[model samples]
Target: MNNIFVYCEVTEERSIADVSLELLSKGRKLADDLKVKLEAVVMGHKVTKLEALLYPFGVDVIHYADDEKLFPYTTLPHTAVIIELFKKEQPGIVLFGATSIGRDLAPRVASALRCGLTADCTSLEIGDHFDNKTQTEYKNLLYQIRPAFGGNIIATIINPETRPQMATVREGVMKKEVYSVKYKGKLNKIDAKSILKDDDFAVTIIERHLEKSKIDIKNAQVVIAGGYGVGSKENFQLLFDLAEVLGAQVGASRAAVDAGFAEHERQVGQTGVTVRPKLYIACGISGAVQHRAGMDQSAQIISINTDINAPISHIADYTITGNVADVIPRMIKYYKKNSK
Candidate 1:
């Protein structure tokens, strides 16, 4: 185990994705535990500017692939170049953000190399394991932990036999931090054209429509979430008003999304995005296990619901028993009065 590689996903803005930076932060810890270098794999048409940003996150070596065909994320070319590099380097561990591009690319590369891949892992760590069936003691294995059975249980997966243990982690599941000192590591430029053939590019991109999303609850420091108890779509406006005053992002449970009270991107749960905000105010939420799996890790939880027996109240740091409509307005008023 020489190096731990993070697949750095570049955004359309010609910047490194926040999830990749988060992975780099976690990978640095893993690399330190294994006594190995933390490396990053960055591929884009013109990603020269993105290379420098990775060092602050504690990247030791950057395997960079810059070429025209690599833009806009076509499956074949990106997969081909990564597979070629993996074959050559044979990294000890590889991590990918469980985003659209990462979900598409990781499985293909794992399949091509005949390696195991754990998708949508919420936790990753290095440890020792004992295989009872094989009677083998595996040391320094990457533990890929995720929610299983619809977030009712957690499962830890290990690829003991694979050379490069791989896992895809969702954004915001891990914290991101920069090292105190900048990493002066090696940057190896890879020639994408050398390994990529004309036939490898089966899919052609005619045009790219990049829509700017307004909501990013995963990165929000304070999240105010609603559930089916919020009632109708119109009543969801209460959440928005509360969020506005609190300077928090609005989140919803799976029930809220399914009931057409909110968008899927605004959903926070096992089936949706996992969030670890500094403050989580769960209003009108029943606190199902699925919903808790996503936000139970918040630093502080304030559950506001009429039902004292709601599952959310059990884990919440503060439980407010009241109607969301009645409670939110008073809170907003108090906040305004106190601030003034």
Candidate 2:
């Protein structure tokens, strides 16, 4: 009754979403720490042979429901399935991806279950908390950590009194790994007709349209990012030039995006997309806590700023004190020269 559950999101391509896979990887660790079996819930059509994809992530139990209405992911029927299943299982902890579907489904589930829900958590761990007023001790609690007070501070939140401690994590915040390629898990088929009702199909999707993203910065091997200190929108061109020379994606801080120096899609921070690149070059970024939470995991960091004491320089493997306008051009020239 008290196991860790991950809602594995399935795409139209009949594959598990990357964020769900990453959650499974983390869920496996949490399950082990709690000495409980890791469980997964997959609701979609034609989701057979998913064991090949899931077991390696250390899932001990898989609750799968296959029905025609399950695909294209309507809000009502899908939510009904999860709500019913969660009630029967009474899990201790539940996790969801902070995607469009997750953002929609998780709150409903939490509200129905009368449980607390934390959104956009950057970190999750098992810890203990003690209440002084009640003189109560809580052990093995799920710690949902994220930025609070407008990203000025990091807050570690815990659900000491709630069952199925719930949180929705962002993509790329957790690393994806296979627990064991040889690992195996048992599957239980859910009766779709028994659990779902006609009223659940009130909302029918008529048509679906998806616009492909122009830039895939998340998967970029190298990232060259700029901030407000980059000067102006025209000055941001230097970052683009450097990116082209290095075959890297151009990223920006929230300040740069607010100043119209870069597009919103290119922003990297708590409110923006999280990225883990092999090399991250920070140009004129003062490195607020929000921005660092997104890119601190980069394999190597190099910060260049006019101020020698910029916050980003603290975490940089190499810090160059200079103007981005001058620094970026020289970088582009030297990189091109070295390539030949």
Estimate, for each residue in 1-340, the C-alpha lDDT of model 1 and write its tens digit. Answer: 4489999998888778888999999999999899999999998877746656888888888988988788878899999999988988899999999888999999999999999999888789999999999899999999998878766788999998987899998877778898745567779999999989988888898888888677899889999999999888888898899899989999999899999999989989766788989999998999877788789999999999999999899999999999888898898999899995
The positional error of residue 182 in candidate 1, measured at the CA in angstroms, is 2.9
Candidate 1 displacement at residue 307 in angstroms: 3.1
- What is the clash count of model 1? 0
Provide the global lDDT of candidate 1 against the true structure: 0.89
In the order shown, what is each candidate's alpha-carbon RMSD? 2.0, 1.9
**TM-score on alpha carbons, each prediction:** 0.92, 0.94
Cα error of candidate 2 at position 272, Å: 3.2
User: Can you write out model 2's per-residue Cα lDDT over 42-96, one digit (the tens) per residue?
Assistant: 9999975798999999999999999988997888898899999988999999999
Q: Model 2 compared with the native: what TM-score?
A: 0.94
Give the C-alpha lDDT of model 2: 0.91
Look at candidate 1 and tell me the lDDT of residue 234. Answer: 85
C-alpha lDDT score of every prediction, in listed order: 0.89, 0.91
